[model samples]
Target: MHCSTPKTSASLDPALLRANFPIFGNHPDLIYFDNASTSQKPFVVLDEVCRYHTEQCANAGRAAYSWSTQLDRAIEDTRARVAKFIGANAEDLAFTSGATESLNMVALAWGLLNLQDGDEIMLCQRDHKSAVLPWYNLKDILATQGKTIHIKTFAIHEVGDYDLKSIKDQVSPRTRLLAMTHIHHVFGLDMEVAEIREIVGDRVLISLDASQSVGHIKVDVAALNVDFLSFSGHKMFATTGTGGLWVNPRVKDSLRPMKLGGKSEATPEAGGLNLKHKNTAELLEAGTQNIAGILSLGKAVDLIDSIGLDAIESHVSDLTVYLYGKLLNLPGIIFAPGMGICRCEAGFGIMSFRFEQISNLDLSFVLDEENIFVRSGDHCTYARDTSEEYIRVSMHLYNTKDEIDQLIAVLEGVVG
Candidate 1:
């Protein structure tokens, strides 16, 4: 199918962009379509991480040495870069191991403070395990304290897109928090957060899990008016073991740090040591951070900025639309009529589908045989689907129209 939309080529040539990623050079024939799981890192990002580890490896925010100072500076620089990427202040962003840890920090912190008997926490059914399990664990903890954690779900219609009307009706005065993923990992659908805020207003605190959205597209916390946002670097072509949380400055004081450690201790000189801490990003960061990973994350964000999010968004939209069209023509391919289409104010490079004639795992194995990599199963979503019948194809900036054509040809040979 021809893309009728006018194509706007990126400033960075597709070949040069592909060359930046080391994985492509290593396996030139590999068609990686599982970016939603984790993105392949560019040479710049890999070098940044390697440089920190090999030349200037030291702990951050502690001690008084040149290496330590360098480490501290790099970490701070990364924080600033991440903050700018999401249109937030550096003070509002806290480094975590990854999106899972970031989500847990806020969910557990808020759950400890606000949850009580008969309080409900609103969650959408489309959430990933990283976004959903944190709250479920908190619910268990709250239950032991004579609090029965109530759950209210926002339904995804039969077509797999989120139904905003369900969210509007689920939110109530007793709702303590509303946890939602900005992008649905399985279907690649996005939510209208502004509409959500309009429907629920400030009556409920909103936490946005941008694990699949953040790096693939632009995220503006101020514009979205969300209380919290979580994202991971690995999903954005950076090294693993790096992610962050953006907390609204207004609620900074209210959120108690769940992971307190060396950096978390402000006053160690006083007779007995103080646990009460200043409400800043440091409070949530806790220990000596992942210096190398953080720097690599910053480099990845810089690379994205250099390429431009507008170009990335347009590239992915067209690629997914093309792939969706091709998949529809293939026999046994099952996807929503609006499968490749996204309703996000901003979209990403992702699409998901199912197969009626073959098992998803078997289909994935067949694709693997052809040197194609795609993700199958619920994609780390335990509550969403138990069967491994769902298949997802997630692309990135390095991907091109030819790659989609290759994927379609391979699938046609295998499944058709």
Candidate 2:
């Protein structure tokens, strides 16, 4: 299917879009605001996933039977569709379990092979732990091999954006790679990666964790020019256990497969064994793929394409501003530092805040009682302090101002 260009509009109708999701019908009182965790699946995606499992169930790239071949072709088609969704080539994208595995693949498969003893890796304390911990794990593994790798820390500005000055000060000649988030999970602000690319120059490879940005905004890898980009499918309206890693053609050869089994070729030699692997995106895919989830991802991309990312972005941004304005009116409300004020012009549909007198956990329990779903905790960032937790309200196109109004009314009653 031909992907349609995203259309920009003044607004979208939330009540109409909400009809496409069955979850809303199943639970009439549910007001889902935790989009950063996982988006509710549209009927198109759910039906496609079910259809593939029941009617066209077969293993891809394994056999020449009609069902198997059909599945294989469908998988490749989905691969191209998903790659196009991010403005990347089909050969450059590889499927993984999720963003966590994708990040780990880069650390183990690429970092293990390319990083040297004196090389330094840059990371942000405010980014998700999945993006930060993999590199540290690489450091530990390299330590056992008698190699020293340094982890340089960067900062996030008071406004929740990347601290460009901090990055400039910390970047060095030995900095081999910089791992960062495209959009902050907790602060819900775009990290401005293009500026980061300018600071690091062309030498340092960049690995971006785009778990929060891809489906929510217009993400073009060609424009960002990052060496590696990773994201989870579930966060973007696809099924769980589905995600992708896009490698820049310049760095694709640098990655060595971490998992090896079926489909990987090896030959015996006099000295030992010689491993032969394709340098394309398939290099990282060693075992049988997630056939059902991947097919659903294609449908999700199609749905997004039909709705247009511009429309989704506009709708969600407006909802975020509305939510922020209402939250600000509530007395004793304290937004997460650096995210205290809503940047109407910038930022995705996410915000974190807490009440001065009410504990985050208590507030979450009260909100749950009201059937208002929200996330409250450290939000999986390395920099979070468990003692100072905040509640996260992440919006999507299906959400409405009426829901936000309800949330505000509940808070008003509690705080009153």
Candidate 3:
């Protein structure tokens, strides 16, 4: 199926695009608004995964057989394709399980090796726990080894973006790294990464969790100039357990492998075992990878490329504006901090809000009964002022204005 928008720059046909996904076919009335959590798989990605299992079921880089060689070539080709998709070199990207593992790798392999006593790492308090917890874990692990590392946190502005002033004020000579997100999972706003680089200067390493922005927006690693970038494929229409981590070659040598297995080379010496680990992106890939999932991720990249990020962004932006306008009309509705005031201008297609009288959990159950699926929780964030949960509605290219209208109608009924 041709998923691309018209050359005349017309809006995408969500109804037509929805045909490519089998989930909608199974549940025709289902309204999927929790796209930030994970997107429904397309037929192409599913078929690619099945093809790999059926045609050539062999381990990558294991043997000299035809199946192994074919699998090895496929994996390398996918590595190059996925790297190019994010404007990066193949040598700088490594396949991982997902964003969680990728972020953990940065903490264990890079942070553990490079950081010293009194070196501080900066993190955003409102970011996801996956991005925040790994560093704190590193701090605890280092303390046992007698190295005292300090963790500093910065706050976000009312517009759901990083507080540039807060970041600037916190940077010190001992600040080694700043871990942040590309697009906030709950706020849906782009964190303005380029501005962040200017504030922290050239000395501080920036590690970005691009879980929400990789397939949703145009991400150029060179332009962002971050030391490390991580994202999950499941959130981008690929299977779970497939993701990529891109490391800048300048900092490649600073990362020590956290895990070593079959592929890593070592030789016996008179003194000890001499470990030979390549200083490229493949240094961390020590075990057999998720071969089928990685192939599906490559297909996901192909599908996204055919559709074009510009068109996808435009379609989702229009949906966000429509959804935000309708939600504003709700009688006792309250948006998350900085969300209502932004007026759907800064972010991608994500919104979190709640009603004055209705409990967010109750509303989620009600919506689920109505076949409208939304996420209701703290969204796995680290720092929140209230324990109250909010209803999150995230959209994608396959979502339609009609679906948003149905959600608003249901919400209005509950309010009335």
Which should have the higher TM-score, number 1 or number 3? 3
Candidate 1 lDDT, 1-416, residue by residue in tens: 11233245554456678988878888989899988888898999989877887887778668888788777887888888889999999988988888999899887766787777888888865568788888888988887887798888776666555677887777778887888878777767666677777888886888999888898766899998999998988999888898888998877877777877777755656585555665457778777777788888999999999899868877787777677777778887666313544322223567777767778888899889889899987777653343424778888888888888988887788777
Native-referenced Cα lDDT, model 1: 0.78
Candidate 2 is scored at a TM of 0.95
Whole-model alpha-carbon lDDT for candidate 3? 0.87
User: Candidates ranked by lDDT, best first?
Assistant: 3, 2, 1
Q: Model 3, range 1-416, lDDT digits (tens) per residue? A: 01122233446778988999999999999999999999999999999989988987889888999889889899999999999999999988989999999999999989998899999999987898899999999999999999999999998776566778888888999999999999888887777788888888889999999999899888899998999999999999999998989999889988787787888765669987676766555588988899999999999999999888878888887788778888998998888754565664534788888888788889999999999999998889853554435899999989999999999989988996
TM-score of each: 0.92, 0.95, 0.95
**Which ten-residue region of model 1 has the weakest summed lDDT?**
337-346
Per-candidate clashes, comma-separated: 0, 0, 0
Per-model root-mean-square deviation over C-alphas? 3.3, 3.5, 3.5
1-416 in candidate 2: lDDT tens per residue? 00122246656788998898999999999999999999999999899889988898878878988998888889899999999999999988999999999999999989998889999999987788899999999999999998999999987666667778888999999999999988788888777788889999999999999998888888999999899999999988899999999999998877778887777765669986576766556688878888899999999999888888888988887777778778878899887743455344544788898887888889999999999999998888864575446899999889999999999999999996
